[model samples]
Target: MAEVRGRDTWTEELASLIEDSGVRYGGDSPPTSFEVHAPQSESGESLKEQALGFVMAWCEILMELGRGFRDILRQNLINEDSYVVRKFGGPCSKVSKRLRFLNDFLPEDRDPFHAWSVVFFVFILALAAISVDPNREAVAPVVKVRQHPPSASRVLLPDGRYMAYHEQGVLADTARFSLVAPHSFLSSRLAGLPGVKASLLEEYGIRLVTYDLPGFGESDPHPNRNLNSSAMDVLHLVNAVNVTDKFWILCHSSGCIHAWASLRYIPEKIAGAAMLAPMINPYDPHMTKEEMKRTWEKWLPRRKMMYSLARRFPKLLSFFYRKSFLPEQHDEIDKLLSVSPGKKDKLVTEEPEFEEFWQRDVEESVRQGNIRPFIEEAVLQVSNWGFDIKELHVQKKCQTRGILLWLKSMYSQAGCELAGFLGLKHIWQGLDDRVVPPSMMEYIERVLPEAVIHKLPNEGHFSYFYLCDQCHRQIFTTLFGTPQGPVERQEETATAFEEEDKEEVLQVPV
Candidate 1:
């Protein structure tokens, strides 16, 4: 006679179920229990109860095996579609076919344990075969990820060219006006500095507008654009945006040329102008020996070399630019941010704000794969500027009172007066600048002797960006009154001004 076990005995029997199932599906087998039990009774009731317990434990084992097979099949499918699988023929497809065949053979009947076991065994053999295949290679799945959108907008000009621009500050009737001409290799977005933005709105109630020159940023390439034509484009931009009031022009480095052109072509439209570490026209015959020496030896040797190359072989220079600076590799930007020997250069590199601004400026400048505008601007800088700086003399008999009244109307103030002379020019230069040598100041002084000049002996060419707050204070104070009251905090937004009615007549300065 044999003894019959209770439900508690089934718990001990099910202990090996999980471990043995793992072994069958490619894991190590667990130790077997050595406890011996008395034989079960031969009566039908006892035998049926034993069979039912064994079937319940077998069902649990099948579930574990099913999970393992599902994971393996998923991995196989991913590998089958991978690059390595496409490049080198592999056994991934064969393994998948075997898995499908095994799944198809699985019975949907009352007792599925034996049939599932056969499928599990076949799966193990298939995996082993795949591992031993000579041409097989491990491959991972490919995933697609999206990138963030750009922070700038493009405006299609009347000439079918696109201009990229950024705007900040409040738009109102009394808003002061500023048109920023950024330095070489800098897009208009460079004007999006926190300090500059704060100072413009808080100090003077001004709106700061900056845009990329043709061939830079998203602006289309205007291969034949001269300094004067570029000024016309800016004027076109001003009218397109409905800026009826006279606006101040601010420039840095080589941007002075554009500012100077604006003053010459549209003198009546300008309230005042300021230039920082401004570059003098290199082609000017009156450039002193000292100026030429500093420009060639100290200030812009690399630019001179590149300009020479660009003038002779533009396409070659374009190829070099694309390979070097066009991509988002950050090599050129890193160089700009790295420590430099010059005081101003080092200052700009160390200042985190300027570093961030410069990096974004360079990136946006080449956003559209148009390095041609930069190259063209470079070539133009070293070449004739198509105008004489001496010919830009102030007209003494001009209606200064009428201009003052117009300014008052724009500012919505009764007695707002011009801070300095009607056509005042301010030139701010850093003595320690290596990019645009301080010697260039002598040329400017010689030509515009009456112009107000601020010489910072310890600063560098990038002093404008590093010392933006101080520069803004000096510039705004000279143009308007001193900044007062609490700093106005406003969210900076971008605006795109499109070309309006073609028949709208534009006033041209005679």
Candidate 2:
């Protein structure tokens, strides 16, 4: 009996507290009473029952508070003179009309208990509708790890910059020679074809190394890096890898300038060099009639515009680069997929394998953030290279048995069986290439007269990927004695446009 009396007393006090709270929140309401009855049990009402009675009274207080907040909000919405209501006229008017309808439905003359009961029932229904299942397991957020290709690896330069590189072919061969390839703008080392590993191992036995230039891909950006400084970084990379034997250099498009710089700076270290559709010094006086005509009409004007933009309106150029070149953006991908094929489709837009490769390469190029290095590389290409092209022309004569012939023969008998293949430089260019005009080939020819010229009549800037098998066969045949086997080819289906190669529509940076 004493326990029952105590529970009743607690319940009465809880009801009184709730009634006072409701009147305080609801504003100028008549006196109201909340009678909370404690459940009777034969074992007597436990503490749990008393606690539940208090919780019920507290819920009633909360419902009254919610009603007060809603009424306040409705009053604010109905105020026509208020700035908030005037500014949001349509929304405020709708809210005011709904509130008025609710008020009319529950008039001031209506019983207070009946009106509060309706509000409490509505609140309970809303709570039930939105309630979450307590038994449900919460899904953990997925943590994504950015994955690079198998060929990708990072090295720390002496200057503390992290340099990303791709190494392909055999690394364990006793007579292995390193072939360093520098990628062009908006391209990664994955752009180069190192041939099938089995064939490279059995025939040439070479490890092809390619890296992201400063400001592109994973390499740290050097805002002030010039062509010569980039060459120096490459040399440091070579030394970091601890390659004692003379290495070969292969470059494409704008990368040719760096190759030339390497040949000048580290002449003794370079065995041989090759440039495919190599970008030439535009100011070279030895340009052919056709080259001069293209330069004057097409190339020069385009370069002048780009240079001016990069120099004066860099922010504008940066904005363009982000919108146009970023692979993560669907705009670039959509543009590529929608472009119509013509003679301009020199790249592997029609080929699935090459397109996939090129897409991944572009994606990785800007993954680190900032396209400034790529832009700087472009500007450096059109501007002065800080070294004369004539310096690369000074060839060291090979001595019999005394001095090692770095570039004398394509294959070397002493260090590598493929060392003799080192000195013979090749510069392959396409007449139809719009990215770097065929006229640029004339400038390369003038500077490096000894460089064997392969002029493709039908191909354009990116035709090498389409004719990748042929290129491999040609390269092997030139270096090694004969072609090993039939090269694997990408599917010949027009999947997307080689939008990157469309220099006229989309400006080629270098």
Task: For model 1, name the residue pairs that clash.
Answer: none
lDDT of 2 by residue, 12-42 (tens): 6765876543323222233365443443562
Determine which window of 10 residues in candidate 2 has minimal summed lDDT. Answer: 485-494
Q: What is the lDDT of residue 46 in candidate 1?
A: 72
How does candidate 1 fare on TM-score? 0.57
| Candidate 2 RMSD to the correct structure | 25.0
**Candidate 2 TM-score, true structure as reference:** 0.55
| Residue 289 lDDT (model 2) | 71
Give the per-residue lDDT digits (tens) of candidate 1, residues 101-201.
43554556624557677767997898589558765322312211222246655676778887777766546344655554544544545544335755456
Per-model CA lDDT versus the true structure: 0.63, 0.64
- How high is each candidate's TM-score? 0.57, 0.55
